[model samples]
Target: MFKSGFVSIVGRPNVGKSTLMNYIMGEKLSIVSNKPQTTRNNIQTIKTTDDYQMVFVDTPGIHKPKHKLGEYMVNSAKDSTKDVDLILFLTNPDGELGKGDSFILESLKGKQCPIFLVLNKVDEFTQDKVAETLSKYSKAFEFDEIIPISAIKGKNVDTLLKLMVDKLPEGPKYYPDDMITDVQERFVVSEIVREKALRCLRDEVPHGIAVDIIRMKKNEKGIYHIEADIICEKDSHKGIIIGKNGAVLKKIGETSRYELERFLRTKVMLKLWVKVRKEWRDNNNLLKELGYKNVK
Candidate 1:
C-alpha cells in the first residue's frame, strides 16, 4: 500500500530541528547555524520511497516574539503542527524541559494528530540518565511514541523513520521519487549567501543582514556566475560587512562559493555587494517582497 503524510518538526530554538531535517532529507534544505531562530519560515522537504512518501515540514523554532518577524516565525511553526498526521516534538536530551517546551506542549493539548516526543542528542546522554529524561517528558503528554535519537550521529534515525512510516496514512505519493524539496532555486541561492554571512559574522551582524540574489547565469565555460546583495540596516553595518580593503566581503564570497559548489556540484563564481536598507525588516512591503510574509 502507498503511504503519504505530512510530519511537522516543532521544538524550541537551537534544539537541532533544522539539523535533523537536513539529516533526514540527506540534503541541506534549511540553513543551520549555532544561532537561535535561524529559520524564519516553513521549509518543506519530500522523502519518497517505494511504498511511502513523507513530506517533512521544517518550521521555525518556537520562541517568544521580540518583533514582527519573530511573531511570524513562531506562528508559522505552530501552524505546521495543526492538521498534520504526525508531529515530531523534538527536545535536547542534555537540557531540561523549560518554559518554551511547556508552551509548545500546552498549545498542542487538544490537537487531533498523534505526537511523538523526540529526545534528540541522546548520544550526549548517558544510559543511566536516558530513562530518567524519558520519564520526565512522558509525564507531560500522552505521546504516541517516545523516541530517543541522536540526529547528528545518525543513531536510531532509521528506527524513527520506520516508526513514522508505520504511522503514515495510506495515500499516493505527493511528489516524484527524485524530488527533494519545495523551495525554489532562487531561494536556495539567497539562503546560501545568508548562510555564509551567518558563518563569517559575529555579534548581531548576521541577524541584521539579509541576502538577495539578483542575477544568476551559466557562462560558455559552464561556470555558474551569480550576483547577490548583502543588505544591512545601517551604513555602519555595511562597513563592517565590507571590512577594511574589502577583506570581509571577499571572505564571504569565497566561503559562499565553496558551499554553492558543494551543493550544486559545479563551479560557482559568486559576487557579493553590501547595501544599507535602513530597517528593512520592519517594512512589510520589503519583507513580503523578500518572501517573509506574516503567517496569518
Candidate 2:
C-alpha cells in the first residue's frame, strides 16, 4: 500500500524546525539561521519512496506580530496546522513550557490530526532533563507521541520516521519522484542570497533586508548569470550592507555565488546591488511584491 500525507513542522524561532526538515529531506531546501523569523514562507519539502511519500511543510516560527510582515509570518504558521496529516511540533527542551510554545499548543489542541512533540537538540541536554521535559509536556496537551532526538546528529530520527509513516494514510504520490520542493527556481535563488545576508549581517539588518532577483539567464558556454538587489529599510542600513569599499557586499555575493553554482550545477556570475526602501516591511504592496503574499 502507498501511504502519503502532509506533515507540518511548527515551533518557536530557533527551535530547529528548518534543521529537522533539511535533515529529513537530505538537502538544504529551507534556509536556516539562528535569528527569529528567518523562515518567511511555508516551504514544502517532499520525501518520496516506493512505499510512502511525506510532504514536510517547514513553517515560519510562530510569534507575536509587530508589523504587517510579522503578522503574515505568524498567520502562515497558524494556517499549516489546520490542514495537515500530522504535526511534528519541534521544540527544544527548555525545561518548562514557555508562553511562545504554550500558545502554539493551545491552538494545536483543536486540530484533528495526530501531533508529535518532537523535542529537538537532545544532544545539548542531559538524559534526565530530556526525560523531565517529555514528562512536563505530556501533561499539558496530551500529545499523540513524544520523542527526543537531535536533528543535527540523526539520533532516534529513524524511529521518528517510522512513527510518522505508521500514522500516515494510504494515498497516491502528490509529486514526482525527481521533484523535492514546491518552490520555483527563482524563489530558491532569492532565498540563497537572503541566507548569505542573514549569516553575514548583525541582528538589526538581517530582518529588514530582502533580495530581489532582477535577472537570471544562462550563456552558451554552460554558465549562469544572475543579478539581484539587496533591499534594506534605510540609507544607513544600505551603507552597512554595502560596507566601506564594498567589502560586506562582496562577501555576500561570493558566498551566494558559490551556493548558486552548487544548486545550478554550473559556473555562476553573480552581481549584487544594495538599495533602500524605507519601511518596506510595513508596505503592503511592497511586501506582496517581495513574495510575502497572503494565500490564506
Candidate 3:
C-alpha cells in the first residue's frame, strides 16, 4: 500500500522553514532571506516517490499583525494548521521559546494531527546542548517527536522525512511526480524580484517593498521579456531602491534577471520601475493586489 498526506511547517519567522522546504523539494519553491516574514503565502510543495507522496505546506511565520498585510500573513499561517496529517513546528535552536511559539501552539491547541518539534540549526550546537534543548522543549509541549537538524547542511533531514512518511496514511498521490509546488510562474518570478530587492536594500526599504509583474511574454527569438514595478511605502524608500545614479536598481534588475533566467532556463530581459504608494500595507485594495488578501 502507498502512503500520502499533507504536512504543515508552521513556526516563528527566521527559523529555517523555507530552507527546510527548499532542501526537501530539492528546489527553490519559496523565497528566503534574513528578513522575517519573507514568505507571505502558503506554498504547497509535493514530494512523490513510487511508494509515497508527501505534500508540504510552507507558511508565513506567526507574528503580531501591525497592518492588514501582517494580518493576512498571520491568518494564512494559522489557516494552514487546520487540515494536515502532520505539523512540523520549526524553531531556531539558539532562541528560547517565547510568546510567538506560545501563540502558535495555542492556535494548534485542538489540532488532531501530531506535532513534531523540529529544532533547526543544530550545526551550531554540541550533542549535550542539543539534548538539553530537546529536554527543555519536551516539558513545554508533548511533541510526538523532537528532532534536531541542520537544514543548511542536510543533517538528519532524510530521517525526518522518513519519520513523516512512516506516520502518513495510505492514500493516492495529490500531485504529479514531476510537479514540485502549486505556485504560478508569474508569482514565482515576482518573488524572485522581491528576494533580489531584499538582498540589495537595507533598513526599512525591504519591508515596505512589493513586486508587481506588469508584463511577461516570450518573444519569437525565444527570450522572455518581463516588466515589473517595485512598490514602496514612501518616496524616500523609492529613492533608496533606485539608488544613486540608478546603480542599485540596475543591480536589482540584473540579479533578478539572472535568477529568473536560471529558474526559467531561458534568456530574460527584465525591466523594473520603483513606485511610491504611501501606506500600501494598510490599504486593503493594495494588499489584495499584492496577493496578501485577508481571510474572509
Native-vs-model 3 lDDT?
A: 0.90
Each candidate's number of clashing pairs is 0, 0, 0
The lDDT for every candidate, in the order shown, is 0.87, 0.92, 0.90
Residue-level lDDT of model 1, residues 1-296, one tens digit each, is 98999999999988889989999988888998888878888999999988899999999999988766677888999989888989999997764667888899999899898899989888888876778767778887889998999988888899999999999999888888888998888788889889878887777787777897888999898899999989898888888899889988888899889889987778998888898988777767777777887633
lDDT of 2 by residue, 172-241 (tens): 9999998899999999999999999999898889989999999999999989999999999999899899
Give the least accurate 10-residue stretch of model 2, judged by summed lDDT. Answer: 287-296
Off by over 4 Å in 2: none
Candidate 3 regions with alpha-carbon error over 4 angstroms: 126-129, 294-296
lDDT of 3 by residue, 1-296 (tens): 99999999999988999999999999998999999889988999899999999999999988998888888888988889888899999987664667888788777777899999999989887777777767767887889988899999999999998889889999998888898888899999999999999999986888788999999999999899999999999988988999999999999999999999999999999999999999998888888888876634
Shift in Å, residue 157, candidate 3 = 0.3
